[model samples]
Target: MMNLKYQMIIQWSEDKSFLVGFPEFPGQTWRTHGDNYQEAVNNGIEALESLVIAYQTTGETLTKPTFNQAA
Candidate 1:
């Protein structure tokens, strides 16, 4: 099993496009127009999976990535 840590933020666009990204994983982003929130999240997950696989293949190690949520 691979250990991956990331946070996602979903935003709506006027043109009916969904934008998603992880604050921790800069440049890791995905967008899907004409999709719902779930669709955007799914796309984000796929992007994360690809990123993790690529990093693991290159023997890069992730050290203690944390996510902070505020109430």
Candidate 2:
């Protein structure tokens, strides 16, 4: 699990599902989603964890967050 916090954007799509996006990661516009908001958030977190692992395995530096997070 990654301790770093990245931005997760959850929005309602026309398909009537929650679309999840990671603005900090440079890849697909929408990473993962779900039928509901909670599901979307859970999926997004899992996707983010996988993404972090992928970057680490590839020895690629992650992009800096666009916004600062409050402690």
Candidate 3:
């Protein structure tokens, strides 16, 4: 796999007793979680890697991450 990077956001869920991670990429949504912060991060990475592979297999172009440029 290419050295691609995607943005990951993690937050604590008071109702779930675990951290939730969301990767900002095309066709990706809430699909990973962890009992703790580290677990969430690890899960997020794995999820992103898997997503990239799936997209490649389907003959879809990889999603390019959006960036905020200062004016």
Q: Least lDDT summed over 10 consecutive residues: which range in candidate 3?
A: 18-27
Task: Summing lDDT over every window of 10 consecutive residues in candidate 1, give the lowest-scoring window.
Answer: 25-34
Candidate 3 lDDT over 1-71, as tens digits, reads 45655677777786664544444564456667888878887787787788778888999887677666699
Q: Which residue pairs of candidate 2 clash?
A: none
* lDDT tens digits by residue: candidate 2, 1-71: 56767899999999999999998887758999999999998899899899888898999998877777599
**Which stretches of candidate 2 lie above 4 Å from their native place?**
69-71
Q: After superposition, how far is residue 37 of candidate 2 from its true place, in Å?
A: 0.4
Q: Would you estimate the TM-scores of all the predictions? A: 0.67, 0.87, 0.72
**Tens digit of lDDT per residue, candidate 1, span 8-55?**
678898778788776665555543322788888777777767777777
lDDT of 2: 0.89
Better of 1 and 2 by TM-score: 2
Clashes of 2: 0
Residue 22 error for model 1, in Å? Answer: 1.5
Candidates 1 and 2 compared by lDDT, better number = 2
**What lDDT score is found at residue 30 in candidate 2?**
99
